[model samples]
Target: MILDILMTFGSARKNEDDCQFNGYLEDYLQLLDNREEHLQVLFQKVVEKYPNARICVGLRFAINKEVVSNQIIGYKDAFKLEGKALIRSL
Candidate 1:
């Protein structure tokens, strides 16, 4: 599993082409944010598509402490655990 995770990370490459397309660094930043959102939605879709296979979407979103707590431990999607519940909850 560590290898799988590492292999995924190893494949990441810089998207300098973003700067070329947007003509500014801010545009590149927006590209990164859009990419992040795409990844988030993709993970959610994957969980919906395959409920049996083990997977997780570990992401941190900025918000109030209450909201953080709710997403991090109060809901099933908190840790985005691979199964029906957070591993700790089980």
Candidate 2:
């Protein structure tokens, strides 16, 4: 769904000529950031049930490096994902 929304935004002819799409994308990312806490709860439950499971989560238009990097890295560490295993999961 996230990828589909990003692809739709990218493919729209209006977005090519208008800079407003950038703002829309930024807003969308912000919405994701806001909703992440609820997602984290679900993730924690899954990890608790499957202690050795490796998981990877990604966003299509993750423009904020600090937020995205911190979240993914946190997931990696908390989930005990390492090296080749992490890459393979991706």
lDDT of each: 0.36, 0.38
Name the runs in model 2 displaced over 4 angstroms. Answer: 1-35, 59-90
> Looking at candidate 1, what is the lDDT of residue 41?
67
RMSD of candidates 1 onward, in order: 17.3, 16.8
Q: Of the candidates shown, which would achieve the greatest lDDT relative to the real structure?
A: 2
Q: CA shift at 64, candidate 2, in angstroms?
A: 30
Clashing pairs in 2: none
RMSD after Cα superposition, model 1: 17.3
Tens-digit lDDT track for model 1 on 1-90? 663542232111234211123122233233446548765565456556654433222211223335455435655344444332321111
The window of 10 residues in a row where model 1 has the poorest summed lDDT is 16-25
Cα-based TM-score, every candidate: 0.21, 0.26
Q: Model 1 — TM-score against the truth?
A: 0.21
